[model samples]
Target: MPPAKKETRPSSRAGRLRAPAFVKNHRGVKNWKEAGAWLEWRGIEDIECITPDQAGIARGKMMPSKKFTSNTSLALPSAVFMTTISGGYPEDGNGFSYPEDDGDLKLMPDLGTLSEVPWETDPTAQVICDLVHQDGRSVEFTPRNVLKRVLAAYSERGWRPVVAPEIEFYLVRKNPDPDYPLTPPVGRSGRPIGGGAGYSIAGVNEFDELIDDIYHFSEAQGLEIDTLIHEEGAGQLEINLRHGDPVELADQVFMFKRTIREAALKHETYATFMAKPMQGQPGSAMHIHQSVIDTRTGRNLFTNEDGSESAAFLHFIGGMQKHVPNALVMFAPYVNSYRRLTQAASAPVNTKWGYDNRTTAFRVPRSDPAARRVENRIPSSDANPYLALAASLACGLVGIDKKVKPDQPIGTTANEDEIDLPRGLLEAVDLFENDKDLRAVIGDPFVTTYAAIKRAEFETFMEVISPWEREYLLLNV
Candidate 1:
């Protein structure tokens, strides 16, 4: 029999918020008139106001250039916050009531995120937004809002968190069949990539056109992408971004995903940030390098004036070691994400910190005292950048506040007896739901909502039958 046909659900726009009649037609120049003038001067015709959903997907509406820049805020359905990764509403079944049923929330644009859409056929611009309720309260479940809350916590302590992300992804041929494995796209050499090519310069040149376009798009979007290298898996590549504010880096990473995918499509290839896209190959990861800076004197809080490691540094690592098990849901968000955390995949399965060691989840890279930082190697490329950064920073802040001291750093692979992180989505979700301190730090409302959504997704996924079950269990069991 032929494979089952996939569901033809309407695009998310069906459930999206509709503009009020007054604002829909009346596009009078107003609060952000200067922004409108600038877009008009640049010949931009449309603007996309984007919000990061719970699943890290960008959702929003495009408006005429004038309307977008003139309006102080864009309103969206409150239900947007409650959307599950599968694009389904909550299945609790008692009426499906949520904030959107009552009203809509305004999306306030972050002016700093304004950028031209270099890949679009038309003259278009895009900006990231933060969701705000009608009464001016921030929406807690939105990934961006969660990150902002974490940043605010750091601010209260008179410190700023800097983050740099090393993103890895794959370039695969477009495969429409669900049962077939994806193959690498044909490069300029007229051959599909095979086997490992870690750090191979020839492997990079094989698809220089795609790389060049990615660089152009990154520059246009103001993304601080520093280096690109071939990774261990075929058609896999990693790009490192320059470290800066946590929120800014998250925004850049979010935009970078869109940029890379668009460039790939233009070249008739596909780009995926999926945690484990192929079997028997190393998985992609979004490794984050983080550090804290004192607001008063601009000194590295992780290091002392004499260039020795400070107590704060130890506390930061201690906090990560303490909280990472519970925060695993944020780092490895999906079921496929757990598949990438195995021993042979070169992914960290335990929260062990060490100096310049990739085997440990957290590694303190060799750098000058001024550049002291911790590299969180647990998050998968599929993880939401905002939530991952927020969880990491929040845990480190907890360490700083509690003065948690870390154990001795390991110089090699962590012992098999070290603390193991959550093995799968169910365990991670249960841990996240029950961790009171983490819920408080990230926000109780978001924790509750996110847990519900993930649980629903897990249930839905469990219902689907896989080829392995049919091939092995069908004949025997």
Candidate 2:
């Protein structure tokens, strides 16, 4: 792949945002006017102005193309940021939460993210929106804004973070009942997918039609797919996105999730991003590959003048090691997330860095100095991409700021059973709320709001009695 070129917002077009390379490739568009022309040319009827909530779910209003083009005012209650995964609001008041009066926040469309909703028959377009107060103040609690804040810190230091995310998910049979366990969807052979097939070409071909739709949808939206492969678990697939600007890549991830699920529904199946969707199968993960680059020269900062590992590189890893545990709640957000963190699930159990060792949480993949990068394997598939990237980058940035040094890299034979991460959602949230270093970078309000939201979710989960509890403890205890 060629190096990403620096993009400058069009000077001639007032209020134009800088479109990333992928968005720039669409219809030769580089600004809102050009994007608008493309929309008109395509005969778009409706525009979905949306923003990601804490759980990465799209929330906002949908309006007609005329209203969207005319820039009609759109507002959503700030309480949406405080919404739990179960769609419940937390009133525990663990910390100062948003919407004290349930006031509205303005939704400002990010024109660079405008693209056609390929699944819609009415020729609809969707664009990610950013939240702001009525007085034009930025809403710091929004997930996208959290990532933007972290990126701004790197920008101030003349550094830019590049990331490529590999998303793993399962193609499962439709199971509407919450009581029933999910099963792998029947493939072309009309049999339930059995066992792990890991990288077999035949395995991928079993659902060739769905994969093709993914490619088609991705291409239509200008979302670049770096690679696609069959993962270890039955009916599991992983799609790797091309490395690029962190914010733009996050937007792509946010969009890709919706696209994949819509595509799956078209095939009469379900695409689930739950970390542990099915029992006795390898869980899904969202492993992020990241590197820092000098903004001016566009040179990879992880490498030194003599082609050896640079201090900045080690400091980044040191940052991840020091802060990741406290920030684990962001990487593994749900109650079910911890179930996938066990060593037996092929997920990293410790925050140990290793050179090309998959067993470790942070793997420095062997590459040329320019391509040197770290694969953070800790994040689960269910995490919000915006917060996950922000937390990881914030950790590395704080490490560089403090000149923290990492422990010696572990080798392939190191102990694989080290259990260092938070054991459950409650513990993870506890760590998240109290980490001062993380609060300094990710901001204090976000920590408090996020922690309260997670606590509410944990409380909700505690209300349910699981099958295991009924079967094991009903009579024995």
Candidate 3:
């Protein structure tokens, strides 16, 4: 998971509770003007203005509440979006370019996301920032703007995309050193996590205190976690969020990761969203359940009035089969991300669509016509929520636009089929750069920057000599 960049001292023990932000006859703050009043009502002493950078890391300014409410000019470097996961800039090459002076981008608050930083020592408010040029144009390179661009594509066609993300993660003992391996945290039994405890009610009880804190933190943030389950891995857990508008859902996932990590810290265990945190355990995935709806009718576009599958549904599947490989880099964004995509890793290796098959990349669950949708199981828990959703929806929309038809649904395990997706970071990056259909939907410049950053990250990873190299190859060679 992305670590929080800015730190605020606890409002009360790292925000175990929320302030009385509610007012008489209260609803939510619908606009910036209303947000100002809500912040004041909450008696916010500090403000943490933030935006998701390319790696989904929180990036932005922190200031006094008065300055924030006064409409202060909050600006960040445009190049902030050009950073790699490691926080270093890539060398200029391979069609990638950066600004000469790193010009400032104005921060426009997405008032709907403004909320209290419950854990801060002083009453603090946090708001997600949207970037814009000083000249009044949206900063297309930013991750949030990238998702907005894709959502606008659906809006133009009078369609809205809905997504529910099932984010899988792990709880492990603290390993401060990077070279050491991770182990499951000792539970209430005082033993390392036992394996094969999938969906065991008793398994969750092992971390009851921690789980309760997670629920508390999420509740304070108004993040509705639909269900929590002990997953197949030793220390793995999954949280499913209720479905809604793609952008809104993405914001919740972005914030939920932070909440999980904080709760873990408070419990003295570490929560990691790394695609494959431990070597032997199943890799983490963020499976997105998605459907398209007619904005005017408020009906699912995947099904007909007669409750049969629609042509748009097949086209969406066909689009994913044809286009998902090119977009895989967004789903598996890091060097570690590919480790989870391998065969037998409890992950999909191909873009085959299947009817409720766990092995296929796209699984169409058996549901009523109204709930008909496809689940994109390719994204790792580590992917930028905005980019992952944007890429997934963009592929489906392109399929709908081109009238593409899908191959026959697979009945058996499709992971046994060819490994259709890119198997490594650099390979996926190359595919992403060459995909014009995806580039046309996701801004071309943004795609270019993304691919270059991935290349730089891969190069950095290659520089490291893993212990395995010395264990096996060094002496043998």
Which number leads on TM-score? 3
Clashing pairs in 2: none
* TM-score for each candidate, following the candidate numbering: 0.91, 0.93, 0.94
Worst 10 residues of 1 by lDDT: 19-28
For candidate 3, the per-residue lDDT at 376 reads 95
lDDT of 2 by residue, 1-477 (tens): 111232334444342443334443442354555555556556678988899999999998988766676646889988888899988978657776555488999998887788889999998988888999999988888899999999999999999999999999999999899899999999998898976799888889999999999999988888999998999998999999999988898899999999999999999999999999999999899999999999898889999878899999999999999889999999999989999988655899898999998888999998998999999999999999999999999999999999889999998644367688989999888888888888988887788889888888999999999999999999999
Candidate 3 at residue 119, lDDT?
Answer: 56
Whole-model lDDT for model 3 versus the true structure?
0.86
Query: Which candidate order results from sorting by lDDT in descending order?
Result: 2, 3, 1
lDDT-wise, the better of 1 and 2 is: 2
Q: Give me candidate 2's TM-score against the actual structure.
A: 0.93
**lDDT tens digits, residue span 325-422, model 3:** 99999999998998888876579998888998989999999999999999999999999999999999999999999998999999987786678888
Q: Which runs of model 1 end up more than 4 angstroms from their true locations? A: 1-33, 92-97, 100-102, 415-419
Error of 2 at 219 (Å): 0.8
User: In candidate 1, which residue pairs clash?
Assistant: none
Of the pair 1 and 2, which is ahead by TM-score?
2
Kindly list the per-residue Cα lDDT of model 1 for residues 1-477, writing each as its tens digit. 111222222235542233222222112222253355446444678989898898788999899875664424569887777877887766543223365364788888876677788999898888888998889999887899999999999899899999999999999999888788888778889988975799999999988999999999888776777899999898999999998999888998899999999999989999999999999888999999999999999999999999999999999999999888899999999999998988644898887899998888899999999999999999999998999999999888888888888888889777344448888898898898877777778997788777877777888899899989999999898
